[model samples]
Target: MSAPQHPAHAQVPHVLAAEPPRSRPSSIEHELPKVGKIVFRVQGIPLEVTLEGLEKSFKSHFKRSNSQENTIDTGLSSLVPCCYGSGHQTALIQFQPQTPKRLESLAPGRCYDFEDPDFQCRITIDQDFMGSTQLYPTISNLRIEADVVAIPGINGHAYGSWTGASKQNRKTMWLRDFMRKDFHTCRTMIFGYHSALLEHYAHTMSDYTEDLLQEVTRARGNAEEMGRPIIFMGHSFGGILITHSIVKAWISKQPGRLCGSILNNFKGAIFFGTPHQGLQHLDELLEAVKKNQGRKALLESIKFGNRDLEDTLSAFKRYCQETKLEVVSIKESRETRKATKGELGELARNGELVMFVAVAFSELKLPENLETTAMAEGDHSSLIYEQGGYV
Candidate 1:
């Protein structure tokens, strides 16, 4: 018997190298953080507190601390808390870079460790500050008007999914190769998150959407990028995430704010192999990975159908009606197989049989779109790494 063979297109080599980013700022500038401001998550404070109360609590803990009384700390430039009733109990602190370690020393774990009856919650540094710092193209001479933002699926690395050191090191990412030849003029930013979907501390889609908004705002800073056209590219579960973010922008009362700006910047989106409808069988997937498997987070996050997916899709359809944001959906044509319980058992019985073959094809029940293309030769994962084919 002959071994399974890939399509002719799959054999094509990635001959093109990634191009260097533009030196001058084009229509958009990817803003890097200056050491002037630091954002912190102030959790545990009662959600019912007034804006004034929130600020006062922060000041008491950071400024007039139990350790140091009567003296106001001069290092803090200002504390900007979120809106009074906003679910996010957070504050942004602008301070001198000279006292970098002061905030940590005060909060220890970035959580307020002080004993305050009114505000007893812990404070931690925002993920935007620690791990997923926005890294976009450096400001060049060009006056950038628009750009692209790419987000990877579950457990997908910000850089790796689109470029080097892929999740499994199987192939070079198509995004890297695509950008060089097709969308060279666009300034691209790859968004990353802590998508540990199964862990007790795992973040949900809403959390990811919020973080994405914050990251984009942080990267753009005071720049006026919202008025310009923006293109979004999401792969796998990222498609759902980007969709939710856009919907949030639409429903947001403050269209002038960061979340609003994200949606207001009308443009298009390209989704690759995103399960628009939903996946089936959480139990079987979980069984495959076992309780403590590393990929458990991903399966747990994506398992079967959930309300989040349906609600987001509904919102997405509404958002499309209200705006002219172009949509593109790409579905994979090839089928891939996985090991199954019965098949695995048979394999174990027959020493010659190495693995089970539970074959399946994956595709989205694509929402209405400006264009829909099918990658005839590609499967779920291969379509993503199809080397410069589509952008």
Candidate 2:
């Protein structure tokens, strides 16, 4: 598919100088670490503080020291914590070269009491462990460099969705193998989150967005191509998460210390089998849930034909216009147990450039205003595996 023409809409120009010079790549470049991760278990995690909230508090910890002229070296590439279980919190902090001393200060057998206007919380560090080094294979020999971050859909596996499923025992995972075998210079990372669609509890897309923002900030430290372009790839519901994350960052005024680099440097996005326009298949899903007396939250969440979708796409389009972002929308082909709404063309409706591709078995009718291409023999997931289909 050739690139879509830039839309003739009101312009939102980007200010090049507004971005920091340090955020750009330097002449002297260094390769990213082969493999690295560090984790700590802290008890007495405040119940009131969500992961995003906790991350904000942690950022404050660094800002305060920097203001005092006693800057703490906090070089975490990503700070992702396991689900709070029994009031105990476990976080995997990925970094490059070495772990941050500020994090190390949260050592085992240490206790800290934090006070605030809203609430006071106490933390007891129980254990700390150095993450293994051989989790991911090395790519230091690659010539080109790009940060490729993948986000899985609802109830999807972070590693499995891209690497291929475990039980099948496939010799090569799509993402890992593709990058390793095809494009040696690309560095890949999976953005994982809790996306169970039918949970008894309630969680909005905004919550998931915040979770992704936390991971993006944490991963920023270890990015091999920090100054280079970043590709935000999302599958199914993962697309929604990416959209919300950017909007959330914008809403927060692009706080200099929180995911500002990601927003500034993000150059492109690839959405797979995503329901950018409401999920037309949702009516049947809601019907089934209504018959079985499912949770109201789930019902309300998937209700189609809402203004939320339009509002989000509008914001995304505005950002793309400002940054000249490249967007690729891929729809599924072939029928499954249930159909998913896959009208994602609007993501590129107002963008300067876009590649709209459709996989075989997909019956989606592309908008007449946009040019689209079809894959001869591919399904929703298989399309991504195709060479040059995603890259």
Candidate 3:
């Protein structure tokens, strides 16, 4: 079992200095310790981006000629459902030159300093997917350098010049995707989510749904054996995923009969912008709509259940019995136009749920000095692309 450690909370003091001096981490960079090392980072991105868009980000400019690859096998065979290996593990995957989008333009800087052991094994994606769980094999004398930043948002969002949040009101953000993988962690993770009745994942009834539990388990087991600490990172949809995974484990009521697929317990978790108690405004609105005009009227108001973000919040009350997991929430700034309804407060009060507040700041104007190269980040710029390092 990993020893319990306090949150490594960091705050960059706003400095009025002339130039931000070049800063480097004093500690040695983390290398994926075991074979088939997997790093899973979840990101909330607009739907416009595709697998192809990702193909472009890690190629030619991102790393050297032989840094990444198009495909690599995970050693696990066809029968094992969870194991996955990107064809491009050593060689960077490139985008078609004819494509109009120049992905690097999304972020201000094209040159990201990748410092991890296998710096070339960085995977770029609009959304952190099942393919994202793998770590590059550093044993091949992979010289570590600058950080391989996963510029978030859709391929368009990366360079499109629009920032706020996804229209879906997604609970995922930057940290999980772009940063967590930089340091090698020894743990396993399982993702779970209850079906949203009015939304995408719904069955004929809501009595009990163990839909994606098995797949999430297989994925974690693959990552664990490969030498990465498995963390079940969930958003509102994924929050439902983890919630149900644990509930299934607790329901079996056995010492070892886990939630269908998770091999054993997970090391730890860090959830950002998730709705644990449930979504407030939408649920009330849906309820009000149900009370007034019929279910049909409510359906029209909600974008045919797609915009009904509160369904997951209602799920906790409807399902899930385990309450022992330590969950943390990262809060949106007060400057947000649409305010989040219920907040679980700080870690001091809720031992299980620690909420981190993210404040958008104006870019600090610097008078340019050769002494400092630590550039100031735009208020809404993606953390992975902006700050670019471990916590």
Candidate 4:
């Protein structure tokens, strides 16, 4: 599929400073170790904290706590900022692979106190997804029958986007905890990309679409594996990316080619709160971008009556009709809280939020029986979490 051309003003520098390099192929193996190799979320961090400062404090704390044991390794592998809420900052902390028993000592739900000469803070820690682009093995005896890949929307975390606070106020990642139990024979995976709405040098939607295709191709490995049935689950803008990817694969289909193999095995897709037509609050979001000096290329492509989005959706529908691919559209029924920039550069709540995408805009007008539609109980951001019962 030919990528749509945007106005010159929508173009930005191609340099992707925020996006990390593609993860090592071996690091995303289907089977993962039970202990040392883990990614966890840290909450309650002050907005002013820097990655360097956070790392230094963690290293110091870990070293002090494990000083009695000379053999313990207290090295950190990576620390990247993640978005969980509006008021405070959150991050994903990953430890070095060599520390096989580290998690046993510092388990989830543990709180840590970090004291610095400049400031002091308390943070809560919890386990995150095993790794980006890795498959989640089934817990049942049922044999693996299909692959389910999930992609989060703009400003969404691969883990946090699918996770939500339950009625008991406990964080529940539905993909790992709930979907695995229900789809016993299906291997699930989550794809992460740099889609922050406010990023200054963010990649275009085409860039993300290509990255997703390449990662899935690498993850599937051999030809037989690539030919296995696959279902895609996308939320918000994620659904747009998925549509572009499928259309790309369909256009590039050829015998024995990777894209062809993927398109051949593509069986279905599920979209949660995806704006198939466009967002209802496009002007408001654009205004927010202007006020905050944010990137606009991606947002511009998804505005109401956007030629690119309409073309992509049309092509996606055509592909589904010819291939008989099943599709499920889950629309959000509530309003999502909007975050505004405060005087201190922190994101603050701006009164009551408005619905970003309307129900009509969220649903795809597919041919008669080609698509199934359902309404979810939460807002746009929470629609993915609502899939627990919908699935």
Which candidate has the highest lDDT of all? 4
215 Cα displacement, candidate 1 (Å): 1.0
Kindly list the per-residue Cα lDDT of model 4 for residues 1-391, writing each as its tens digit. 1211211111111111112232223322222223324456566667787666666665555553544422212232223322222345555555443332444466433444344544366665655332243333454465557777888877667766776555444445656544444454666778767655554656777787888887777667665567778878888888888999988777766555558657877877887778888765655446556744435656788888889888888998888888767677776777876655556744444535777678788777786476767766667665665321110
Candidate 2 accuracy as TM-score: 0.52
Better of 2 and 3 by TM-score: 2
Best by TM-score: 4
lDDT of 1 by residue, 80-186 (tens): 22322234343333333322344545532234345555755554433232223222232356555455677776645554455322333323333433342344445
Candidate 3 stretches with Cα past 4 Å from truth are 1-82, 85-181, 185-211, 220-229, 254-263, 283-326, 335-391
- TM-scores, all candidates, are 0.53, 0.52, 0.38, 0.66
Better of 1 and 3 by TM-score: 1
**RMSD, model 2, all Cα superposed?**
15.6
lDDT of 2 at 221: 53
**lDDT score, candidate 2, position 164:** 26
lDDT of 2 by residue, 343-380 (tens): 54111112122222223212123342221322222344
The better candidate by TM-score, 3 or 4, is 4
Please give the range of 10 consecutive residues that has the lowest summed lDDT in model 1: 8-17
Name the runs in model 4 displaced over 4 angstroms: 1-63, 66-131, 139-142, 254-256, 291-294, 348-352, 386-391
Backbone Cα, N, C clashes tallied per candidate: 16, 9, 38, 0
- Regions of model 2 farther than 4 Å from truth: 2-135, 141-144, 163-171, 222-228, 287-303, 339-376, 381-391
